[model samples]
Target: MSSFVLVDRPVPEVAVVTLNRPDRMNAMAFDVMVPVRDALVELSNDNSVRAVVLTGAGEGFCSGADQENAGRAPHVEGLGRPGFGLRSLELLEDVVLALRRLHQPVIAAVNGAAIGGGLCLALACDLRIASSTAYFRAAGINNGLTASELGLSFLLPRAVGSTRAADIMLTGRDVGAEEAERIGLVSRVEDPVVDAAVEMGQRIAGFSQPGIELTKRSLHAGMAASSLESYMPSEGLGQLYLRLLTDNFEEATAARKQGRAPQFRDGR
Candidate 1:
């Protein structure tokens, strides 16, 4: 827990991860995530580490994947290992699951601009307490990336509502900390993410472990993954799977390129 990741293995098992790449606004690269996933797994398993807090070292939380790494639509491939693959999206899922699977408490101390994948970091936390200056954004849509990618597709709606999630994520707009609180995306509004996270950690540490763990699981258990089956598909799919089956996908992309709203051919 102390080596690969910066660890302060104190009582109640409070571990903090500084995204460590403030140089590019804490932009995430493969190297950064390896340590991040390692940190998450290490702290999660250590019995002494009862709680975990994630934050960035610089001015931003995380800004998603390295732009140089971006490429075509998700296509799975095996990385030679049985379960491990080199697919970018699959690894993203791995990171998300690692955060979710941890029995110990996890919190996001949003210190600054949590944009793109950075915003997803906040979403990953069991609770998010943002600094007054923190910003929540979804820049993926602006780059032709799916907001659904990086678990945002599933997490945002649960934090807010399906409609509101779509509005922000699809529009690639930034939401302020106050607005995040207003829309029910965050639990606290304050500065110094580490301090806020530690305060919450101390409070929860007073509780029994199982009770805390179960409550956390129960709270987050069913969130994520938009099942269009229950949704009214008339609105939009963000050029989802169905759109790619025909020329409508091209139409949707063209509209976005033209700086206009997508016009799906099917009225309903």
Candidate 2:
């Protein structure tokens, strides 16, 4: 609901959440990000929405925390300096977790620079697609701090592998769109990335709701699963649950025979 975040239903079942502070390159100020977290939570509960696309308003996706003016951290007005810092960080951590916890899939449209916390923000999403001009940086090291804020240390290694993540984070270098795609930091690079992300979201929206949600859950579970033996059964259980609960598989088969797309009405 904050002016800093704008949510629009660009297609039938897809919602686009835009970070609206172009002048500051949509910096991750508390005022901007708190609402972003709230908006994702709102969309998660809205059964009408099946997918989400997150992007920034201008050339830059987000320049990380605003150095000039970060605004006030929510609900920390009366705390000491150390307490305030901890609580402020917890707020940002909540945003990252919210993206992972949302029932609907989220695709980050990285239009331009995604530095420090901004990079972490994009990684938190289920998918990422970058504009041709987009770039990313593990900026904390450049700022004389560790490059580990907002789940960066945890997510980056999983995203691009530990060796590559170490190089990027330690060197504090920018990774452009092409390199990002090659390194698997992003799924693809395209012109007008938001449109591409929305297209991807629309494709996901066409599937059965429970099918998609369970798949997302399985993917996240796989990330933390101790071993293949521990993970496979959970994934199989999800498949069986949907296969038995809905007539989607039969409908898909019928549609295939009729040379038409699956209606996916049972899950809806």
Candidate 3:
């Protein structure tokens, strides 16, 4: 295992990759991201491994891009790809996308305050299992980071409703695990992400690898056909669709008369 991952003893055939920077709240640095990407690729190739549980160490699952290396890409000496300026930081996002291509299921263990890119990290997983202590917030609006740096904007709306994504992104609301569960943002809420991930991974691993991989491919491809678009279309179309949904006069009337929040079923 690379230093970037605090590899736990395999839970039978499952591999748990932990972001090792506990002191920094498991923040991403260039050194870390590079190894993490490699670890993901390396682990995927290991025939002994059947599933992946990705998470971080300490009180934070991930705080987003490392402020120090915010604008840089990760590269080994003498290896650089042209036109891939954002590839270093975006490597993690690519790793997330690659999860669907793997023969095993990828589960996210979101244990703490996951902000900015951290939320995107969780979004990349096929299933997200958050701890009770977990809280989520978007960084693009609150901080100066672009929403697309990770996969936040693209994944958020689908995880929640697009309108809720707008409300969460524009307002930068810190969503706790209970509400996250209610909104279907998290598959389950457990005390620690590792336990949650392992429990789910065991269940998912019971399925045949090829069949599981195919299922993952179909699910992500659907998202790819939609969520992988550039931020402009994603943001604009999301807002437009949301506005159209909210424009239903009868629903609005019912919501007002009921004295409760509007219940828009086809939210995202």
Flag clash pairs in model 3: 74-88, 162-268
1 against 2, candidate with superior TM-score:
2
lDDT of 1 at 194: 83
Report lDDT per candidate.
Answer: 0.72, 0.93, 0.73
Candidate 1 global CA lDDT score: 0.72
Indicate whether candidate 2 or candidate 3 has the larger TM-score.
Answer: 2
Q: Which candidate is the best by TM-score?
A: 2
Best first by lDDT, ranked: 2, 3, 1
Worst 10 residues of 3 by lDDT: 226-235
Question: Which pairs of residues clash in candidate 1, taking residues 3 or more apart in a chain or in different chains?
Answer: 13-49, 13-50, 62-118
TM-score (all chains, Cα) for each model: 0.74, 0.98, 0.75
After superposition, candidate 3 runs with Cα above 4 Å error: 68-92, 224-268
TM-score result, candidate 3: 0.75
Cα lDDT tens digits, model 3, 147-230, are 554667778888898988888888877999999998989988987569768877877665445445556766665666734554
Model 1 residue 26 distance off true place after TM-score fit, in angstroms: 1.7
lDDT score of model 2? Answer: 0.93
Instruction: Flag the better candidate by lDDT, 2 or 3.
Output: 2
lDDT of 2 by residue, 41-108 (tens): 99999999999999999889999989999999978878999999999889999999999999999999
For candidate 3, the per-residue lDDT at 185 reads: 91
